[model samples]
Structures are given as C-alpha cells and as structure tokens.
Target: MDDDENLPRKTNDPLAALVKQDLDPLSVDELDERISALKSEINRCEAKKSFAVSHRASAENLFKK
Candidate 1:
C-alpha cells in the first residue's frame, strides 16, 4: 500500500497560470494546440466580459428611470 496514493490531485488550470508552464519539452503540434486552446479561451472570456458589461448597463438604465 503506497502512502502517496491517498493524496488528492490538482487539476485546476486557469489560463493565466498556464504562462508559467514548462514548454521546453513540447513538440510543434503540442505548441500549436496550446495556441489554439488559448485563442478559444480568450474569445470565450471576451464574450463573457461583453455580456457582463451589457447587463451592468441595463441595470444602470433601469435604476436611472
């Protein structure tokens, strides 16, 4: 019975923390995949930001009336 087997694994990988990952071992295809994934994440975040801004503006308009 190994004692290490009881430890919980860490799987949270928010995009900002990804910049600190070691990239020296990745192949070209892996790097391309990372780039594509990051781009998709950026777009998703932008969409959320826009929605939040619009929602906030709507709330403000309602209160002003």
Candidate 2:
C-alpha cells in the first residue's frame, strides 16, 4: 500500500475555500466585517460544542445509575 493512502483526503469544503480566499483585494472595512463574521461563527461553534459535551456527560451519568 502507498503511504498516501494513510493521509486524509480533501473535500470541496466551504470552510477550506473560505480560508484560501484572497484577502489582499479587500478594503479595511471589508476586513473588519470579515473578522466580525468569523468571530461570530467561532462563538456559535463553541456553544454547540459546550452543549454536546454537557449532553454526553449527562447521558453517561444516567447510564451509570
């Protein structure tokens, strides 16, 4: 087997495209807006992660009883 088979394959992911976007053409205001949007997305992801963790812990506790 080739060593390349052990590596993860890339998909047509929107997040990956977003990260690769050319930002040099954007104005200062545009950059600020992009930063704000990214920050909001980060917060949303964190909230979902927190909820999932808590839910899993609850399930484990219930199963232990």
Candidate 3:
C-alpha cells in the first residue's frame, strides 16, 4: 500500500486545500496573482486585529472610569 493512502484526505477547509496546492503547474503570472491576493488578505486581517485591540482598550477604559 502507498504511504500516502494512510494519510488523511483533504478537508473542507479552503485554506488547507490552498496550502496543499501543487504550485509547480502554475504559471509565473498565476503565482504573482496568488501572492498579491495573499498580501491583500494579510492586510485585511491586520486591520481587523488592530480594530479589535483598540475596541477592547476603549471598552476597558470606559469601565475603569
């Protein structure tokens, strides 16, 4: 039996599938596009995190007053 057969199959998670994607078949342009999209996602996540942190601090200050 193949060793890979013992491994778990792909999950329903898009991020997990993306991480396991075969990049060798992709063209340079496709790779560039992927990188750009990933950067945009990173920026979005960072903005959300910043907002959450500031919002929590504001809430804490309000209760302390």
Candidate 4:
C-alpha cells in the first residue's frame, strides 16, 4: 500500500551500519597545529590591514582617539 515496502536493503548500507571503531578526541598536537596555522593567517591579515591603514592615514585619522 506504501512506497516504504519497495526499498531494497544491503548489509553495507551506510544508514544501517554501526561504527566499529572507538571514537577519540582530537590530540593536543593536532589542536596546536590548527591553532598555529590560524594565528599565522590572522597575523598576515593584520599586517596587510596595518599597511593599508598607514597608507590611508587621512581617512583613518577620523577614527583615531
């Protein structure tokens, strides 16, 4: 009477499979590596903005304390 009865199932179906591997938290080394990469990216953007601000001193002076 319904489309639900028409589906074919497999032993390897992703939705039906149970994960056998033990789940583990990310290691501190991995976390630190990601943090260091992010820091470098942030520093690069800050340096670029600093250079642009210095070049546009007249426009930037409006916000100076």
Q: How many pairs collide in each candidate, listed in order? A: 0, 0, 0, 0
Instruction: State the displacement of the C-alpha of residue 36, model 1, in Å, after optimal TM-score superposition.
Output: 0.3
lDDT, model 2: 0.93
lDDT (tens digit, per residue) of candidate 1 on 1-65: 79966875456745436766899999999999999998999899999999999999999999999
Q: 18-60 in candidate 4: lDDT tens per residue?
A: 2332325658897687678768988999999998988799667
Model 3: lDDT to the true structure:
0.93
- Give the least accurate 10-residue stretch of model 1, judged by summed lDDT: 8-17
Give the Å shift of residue 45 in candidate 2.
0.2
RMSDs, each prediction? Answer: 9.9, 4.9, 7.8, 16.3
- Residue 55 accuracy (lDDT) in model 1: 100
lDDT by residue (tens digit), candidate 2, 1-65:
99977876578868868988999999999999999999999999999999999999999999999
Model 2 clash pairs?
none
Per-candidate local distance difference test: 0.86, 0.93, 0.93, 0.71
- Give the lDDT of residue 9 in candidate 4: 57
TM-score of each: 0.74, 0.84, 0.78, 0.47
List, residue by residue over 2-28, the lDDT tens digit for candidate 3: 997787766786877988899999999
